[model samples]
Target chain A: MIIGALGPEGSYSEKAVQIWILRHRLDSVGIQYFADIEDAFLAVIQKKSDLSIVPIENSIEGSVGVTLDLLHENGVEIVGEIVVKIEHCLLSKGGPEKIKVILSHPQGLAQCRHFLKKYFPEAELRSTGSTSHAARLAGEFEEMAAIASPEAAECYRLKVLLPNIQDRKQNYTRFIALRAAGKNTAEQVFEQVLCDTEEKTNRPENSSHSAFKTSIIVYLEKDRPGALYEILGAFAKNKINLTRIESRPSKKELGDYHFYIDFEGHISDAIIKETLKDIKTKTDTLKILGSYPAFKA
Target chain B: MIIGALGPEGSYSEKAVQIWILRHRLDSVGIQYFADIEDAFLAVIQKKSDLSIVPIENSIEGSVGVTLDLLHENGVEIVGEIVVKIEHCLLSKGGPEKIKVILSHPQGLAQCRHFLKKYFPEAELRSTGSTSHAARLAGEFEEMAAIASPEAAECYRLKVLLPNIQDRKQNYTRFIALRAAGKNTAEQVFEQVLCDTEEKTNRPENSSHSAFKTSIIVYLEKDRPGALYEILGAFAKNKINLTRIESRPSKKELGDYHFYIDFEGHISDAIIKETLKDIKTKTDTLKILGSYPAFKA
Candidate 1:
C-alpha cells in the first residue's frame, strides 16, 4: 500500500504518519510526500496513493483548518484514525553548544517557545517547511539546530539537543487515514461482534446490527434564519446524540457555512437513514464522510 | 508613550504599529520590541511599556487565538485598532538565484506555499518567529532568504530578493493597541466618542438610547438547559442587538465556557445598562471589558 502525507521529511504530518507506520509495522508501504494537505488529498484522489494520512486536530491548536477544508472539498472516506502523543524535541547538527540558530514549523516553535527562550535565549529562531526539514537542514549546517520530533532526528540523523522541549506534556495529535470509498477498512482490533447467531436467527432471519458512528457534511440551501436549527432538528427528532458540529465558511459563497456533523449510529440504521433522507431534502447538499466505529481519545 | 511590538524590524506587527504610530504619532511616543505578542502584553501588565500593539486577526487566518486568549486573561484593555494591508517580499542574503532556503512565519509561509512551489520549487522553506525576525536571520547568513514585509529588508539591511512574493494580494491584519486598565494615561490622541452624538441629544433626557458599543465577558451561574438563551433574552426584550457572541472553554471548570459578548451600545445607556443588570442577575459573574466606538474592519 502507498501512503501519502504532508512532507519534505519532518512535518507534524510526517511524524504522525511515521509513528503510525512504525506501530502498524507497515514498513513495506510506499510513502510519498506532498507540499501541503490539499496536494496530499489530490495524490489520493488521483490514485497515486492507496491510503493517505492527514492530521485532523491537535490538542493545543484545536482543529487543523486546512485538513477540514480539504476534507470538505474532496471525496474521501476516513477509514481509520491514529491519535499519537507528540513530544517535540530540540535537535542540532553537532553538539548543543555548536548550535547557533534554531529552525522549526511555526506551531512547533510556538509549542517550544518557553524552552527555546530559556535554553537558546540568544540563538535566532527560524521557520522551516516542517520540523523534519529543519532537522535535515540542521544536519547540513554546522551552526544550526532544529525544534522538531524525535522521529525527525532519526529521519535526518541529528542529535537531540534537548528532549521533551514542548511547553505542554499532554501534546497529542489526531490523524485520519483515508482510503477509497466503499472499502470496509475498519479493523477488527477494536470491534466486538454483538450478534449471537441463534438469537439472530430467532428474530429476523437476515437481520444484522453493528454499533457505528456517522460523519456527514451538509450545505444549507441558503443563508437564512433558522437554517441551522432545521438541520439540527433531524438528529434531535431521531434521538441521535450529536458528538460534534463545526461550521466552515463555504468557499462557493461568502457568509455561507458548510456544517460538518458527527453523531452516534450508522447511516444504514433505519432511523438514521430515515432522518438523513429528510435532511437531504432540507439541505442544499449532504455528503457522508464515513460511518466507522468511534475511536475513543 | 512607549509602545512595545514584536520587532527588530519590519514585520506584519511592526508595520501595523508603524502605520498607526506614524498616522497618530502620539506626542513624545517611543517604540520597544518584545519576543512575541504575549510578551508585548506582559510589558504593559508589568509596567514595562505604556502601550502595546499586537495583531488580533488576519483576513485568511480568522482570529489569532493567542491574542484573544491574552485579552481574556491580561489586565490590559484594547484602546484602539488599525488594519494594515500585508505585502510579502522574498529576500535573500546573497541574491535570488543564490537563495537555497526561504524562511518566514508559518502563516506567512502557508499563504505563499503555492508561489513557493511554482517558483523556488527546490529552495527549502523555513519558519521563524515573525517576518522581521526571519529577515534579520536571513541577512546574517548567505544562501538563505526570507519571505517578509518590504520594510523587513530595509530594517535588516538586506536586499529584497524578490518583490510581491505572496500568492494573494489581499492579505491584511487587524491590530489592537492595548494598555493597562486605567484612565487614558499617555495622551488623548483619540477618544472613544459616540458613534452618533445626534441620537443621544435628540432623545429625551431620560431616554435609554446609546450610540456606542460595549463588550462584556460573562460566566454562567450553572450548566443547564436554557441558561444562555435566558441570559441573551434580556437584550432581546430591550430591543438591544447582539453584534457578536462567542464561547471559549473556561479552563477552570469542565464543560463551562466564558462568553464574550458585544452589544449595540454602551452601559451608560439606560436600556443597555438595565439589560446588563438583568443579565448579571442570572449569570454567575459578568465583567465589562470595555466600551468603545464599534470598529469598522
Candidate 2:
C-alpha cells in the first residue's frame, strides 16, 4: 500500500500518517512525498496513491485554505482523521550564540513571534517552503537556526537549541485521510481497519454511541437576508451538533461565499440523511464530503 | 492627520488608504508604515496615529486571521472601509528572459501559480514579507522578478514585464480603517466625511437608504447543538442581511472558535440594537466592532 502526504519526510502530515499506521498496525506501506498539500491530495485522486494525509486546520493559524479549497473542488471522501499536537522547536548546528539568521515556514515564524522578538531580536528571519525544508537548510550553515518539529531535527541531524517555542502552548493541527470516492474495496478495508482499532481500544460496538462526524459544503442560490440562517436551521431542527463552520470565497464576487460545515453524525443515520435532504432544498448546491470517526485526542 | 498602514510604501494597504483619501479629498495626511499588521493596529490603540488601515479580507484569499484575532482582542473600532482591486504584475530589472528567480509574498505567489507554471516553469519562487519588499529586492538583481503591484514597479524603479498576471482577474482586498473606541469627536468627523462623499455622489439624504455594515464577534458560553443557530436566529428574525460570517480559532482548543459576523445595518438602528440585545442573551460574549459605510465598489 502506498500513502501520500506533504513532505521532505519530517512534516507534521507524516506524523499524522504514522499515528494512523500505529492505530491500524499496518505493514508493508510505502510513503510518497509531495511538495504541496494539493499535490498530495491529487495523488489520491489520480490513483497514484491509495490514500493521502493532509493538514486541514491549525489551532493557532486557522484553516489551510488550499486544502479546504481542494476538498471542495475535487471528488474525494475523508475516511479518517488524526490530530497531532504541534510543538515547535528551535534547531541549529551550533549554539544559540552563533545563530545570526532564523529560517522557517511563514506559519512557524508567525507562531513563535513572541519568542523570537524577545530572544533573537537582532536576527534576520527568512521564509521557506516548509518547516522540514528549513531544517534541511539549517543543517548546512552554522549561523542559521530553524523553527520546526523535533522529528525534523532528528531527520536533519541538527541539535535542538530550544523546545516548545511557539507563542501558545495548546497548539494542534488536525489532518484528514482522504481516498478517491466510489472505491468500494478501499472503503471495506478502511472499515476493517476501524473495527480492529475499536476492538483494541475496547470501544462500544453500537454504531449509535460511536463518535462520527459528517462534513458538507453549501452554496446559496441567491443573496438573501436569512438564507444561511435557514440552511443552518435544518441542522438545528435535527439537533445535530456542529463541530466546525467556515466560509470560503466563491471566487465569483467579493460578498459571495460557500460555507463548509462539520457536524456530529454519520451520513448513514436516518436523521442525518433527512437533515441533508432538507438542506439540499434550501441550497443551490450541497456536496457531502464524507463521514468519519472523530479523533479522540 | 496621520494614518498607520502595513507598508514598505507600495503595499495594497497603502493603496486602500490612497483610495480612502481620494474619496474624501483629504490633504495634509501623513502615512506611518509598520512592518506587520499587528504593529499597525497597535499604533491606533496606542494613539500614535489618528487612524490605521489594515486589510481585513480578500476576494480570493478569504479573511486575514491576525486582523480578525486582533479586532476581537483589542478595543479598536472600525470607522471606515476601503476596497482596492488587486492587479498583480511581473516586475523585473530586465526582460522576462533574464529572470531566474521570482520573489513575492506567499499569497501573491499562490495567486499566480498557474501563470508562473506555464511561463516561468523553472524559475525559483521565493517568499518575502510583502509584495513591495519583493519588488525592492527584485530591483537589485537583474535575474530576479517580482509578483507585485504596478505601483511597486514604479516605486522600486523596475519595469513591468507583464500586467495582470494573477490567476484570478476579479481579485480585490477589503481594508478597514480603525480608531480607538468611544472617540466621539472622531466619530463625528468620520460621519461628516461620509456625508460629504454622499453629496458628491448625489446619494439620497435619507439615512435609512444609506449602505452601512456592522461587525461583531460572538463567543458561545459553551458548545451545544443549537447555540450558534440561536444567535444567528436573532438576525434572521429581525430580517437583517449578513454580509460575511467567519470562524477563527479562539486559541483555547482545536474545536473552540469565535465567530466574526458582518451585517447590513448600523449599530444605531433600532432593529439592529434589538437583534444584538437578543444575541447577547444567547452568547457569553458579544463585542460590537463598530459600523461603517460599505464600500460602493
Best by DockQ: 2
lDDT of each: 0.68, 0.83
Candidate 1 per-residue lDDT over residues B1-297, each given as its tens digit: 788898766778777677777777667777888877778778888888888888865554444656766767766666666677778888776867788878887767766767887888887776566778889889888888888888888888788767876655667666778878775421111122222222222122443334455667787754343456566667767777664454544544222456666666655565665677688678887766665544454
lDDT of 1 by residue, A11-57 (tens): 67776677668767886877798766667777778998988888776
RMSD of each: 7.7, 5.8
Q: Can you give the TM-score per candidate against the true fold?
A: 0.74, 0.91
Please write out the lDDT profile of model 2 over residues B203-239, one tens digit for every residue: 2246662398888899985566788888889988878
lDDT string for model 2 (A154-247, tens) is: 9999999999999899899999999898644222333434344312222235766239888888898556778888888998888888899999
Q: What TM-score number comes out for model 1?
A: 0.74
lDDT of 2 at B249: 88
The C-alpha stretches of model 1 lying farther than 4 A from their native spots are: A6-39, A93-95, A140-142, A151-161, A180-265, A269-288, B18-26, B91-95, B136-142, B150-165, B182-289
- In terms of lDDT, the poorest run of 10 residues in model 2 chain B is B196-205
